[model samples]
Target: MYKKSKIALAIGLSVGLATTAGAAETNWRMATPWSGGPWLERDAQMFADHVNDLSGGEIEIEIFPGGTLGSALKVTNSVKSGVADISHNYINYDYGTDPTTALLAGHSSGLTPEEFMMWMYQGGGVELYEEYRRDMFDVVAFPCAILGTEIFLHSNKRVETLEDFQGLRLRTSGAWSELASRLGASTVVMSGGDIYSALERGVIDAAEWGSPEMNRPTGFQEVAQYVIVPGVHQSGGFLECQVNEEVWTGLSEDEQDNLRLAGKLSVFESWLASSYDDLDAYEELVSGENEIVHLDQDFIDTIYEETAKWEDEYAEDNEWFARVLESQRDFKETMSAWPEYRLPIGTMGR
Candidate 1:
């Protein structure tokens, strides 16, 4: 009888342990807009890996690259609708759903990468983002990656002044396209895959894609001769990770915290890795056949002025845009003291 009782007790304990483990384990699908082999895609994967490690295997996430699950632009919708448990994407991709997202994604003459980080993490930007996503899409969202300044334009025609943009055929998107039009350029919107062919065929005079590291692999140098500097359109940008509201709510508080930490870690690592790679890519571009054209300061100032006017006009009509724009401008003003206090620094290797 004693042996039988001991056996029964052992069986009960094993069953309880199994049940607990089953309840703790969770599997999720993460959809991203980035294709394979780019830092953007790797960053999303890294976040998933970090979540798995941090959660002690309690959670596992699988990454689906761009177009694998659905249209990249609809990733947020996929997550919200449960097609994907989570998604990694740019906030601007949802601009059609809400114009406020354009400002969230970083605009011309907006926050630099460092300032944007400070604004997002410390200056209530994260809370605002969460509020916006929750109300707009019924999802939980946070920035998972921060990218540095992008290349202004890769062109066959030289563009140094505002006058040079006159009648120039440029391929771009979002607010930049509008700005380009305002500057007298005939702007065309096309996918990144189509840029090289368009440039080679003289269908577009110029195009703005990404930073040096991100653009090099696309072989822009082989087709475009001029590499313009200072991407005023997108000085910096944020990639976000969004979770389905139901999935987020189902997680334990500890699991939720782990996901947030994983995102922050991914952001830090990706920023450093991409920034260093961009430096190397820039050096290569300088030595390669493509001519580097630095936009004149006067032209850059004119762009800033026009950007301010564009944002102000949009903000006048959009309450959320106004609020976000106010927050960013306030942060920029508050942090303006640092540049004055510190000694001026030159470009790397200058």
Candidate 2:
């Protein structure tokens, strides 16, 4: 499903572009909160690469990592004001901007990344996206990369039940904060770089971050001594890349399609990379003598039940979120009857 019909023409145009010595170059700035390690940042680079190839070097994209331009919290405004031509940030970071955005980020556990695309592209999600953003802000955005489930809780102290979370400072971000607020733990949302210091200073006792692969670079093994699996808070989530409205509309159909196609690959491959990294990280954690604890099924179940309550309370306060949640639920209703229909079959590896 590549946007480009063939690579030969793109490459040919690119070659011609390289020969145009006096040609004025077109360059755009792309930014992401993640540094170069995780696939989130890698996906940004991939998008830039595709733009260059598809545009025949008529437009060049340069990527900035770890919010080099500014805090990840500011990326939305940054895109709107044209401070940056392109930027990647999770919808969770700005849920207050529009609580509906939380549903956009998959808090209700609706669509898997690929299934969500069906909802976004062919389904009405894409149209809704065009309507909402255009109405609210002048910028244009889409569900670019849909990041898979993040990692489970890994901590110095055991998380056996709801009581264990009480008074235990944990490092969490976005929607997880909703669960934490309900669980009575003082959850702190900090940049990835802050996890180590927070743990070392005893500012936090537990941390649940991205996939194991994504967190390995943070050296969690050296800090927190426990690892827990099956992150119930985030099943399969959506991550977006936003472009200035003017910039988006100016693209040729092929360029727009290329961006959409590249985004799909980025999210899918990011999930694959995460799985591989998690496997390897687990092995290293065990072999490297890091303490690894497997939460009993009961423990995980308790977490899920409590997490569900938080989600319910959340949706009650946010009507738009409720609407999006209901849509996905109805879609899933029919899916339950259709054996061939499932939640992100491609991701779960059926």
Candidate closest to the true structure, highest TM-score: 1
The estimated TM-scores of all candidates read: 0.90, 0.81
Predicted model with the maximum lDDT: 1
Candidate 1 local lDDT, residue 196: 93
lDDT of 1 by residue, 1-350 (tens): 00112322353344323333555677899888777545445677767766666655566788888787788768887898899999888888887777788778887865788778889899999889989889878999988888788999999999999989899999988888888898789999887888999999999999998888889898888899999998888998788899999999987675676677667777777787778888999999999998999998898898889988888998998888899889988998899898777665455476
Any runs in candidate 2 off by more than 4 Å, and if so which? 1-25, 108-130, 296-319, 337-350
Estimate, for each residue in 1-350, the C-alpha lDDT of model 2 and write its tens digit.
Answer: 12332443455365534443344677888766766675445556655565566556666777787667677667777778777888776767776677667667766353455566666665677667646666665666666565665556768887665677688788887766876777688888787777888887778898877766667788876877777656656656767777887788876565666566555555555555555666786677678756666556775566667755665676798666666666666666755665565454436755
The weakest ten consecutive residues by lDDT in model 1 span: 1-10
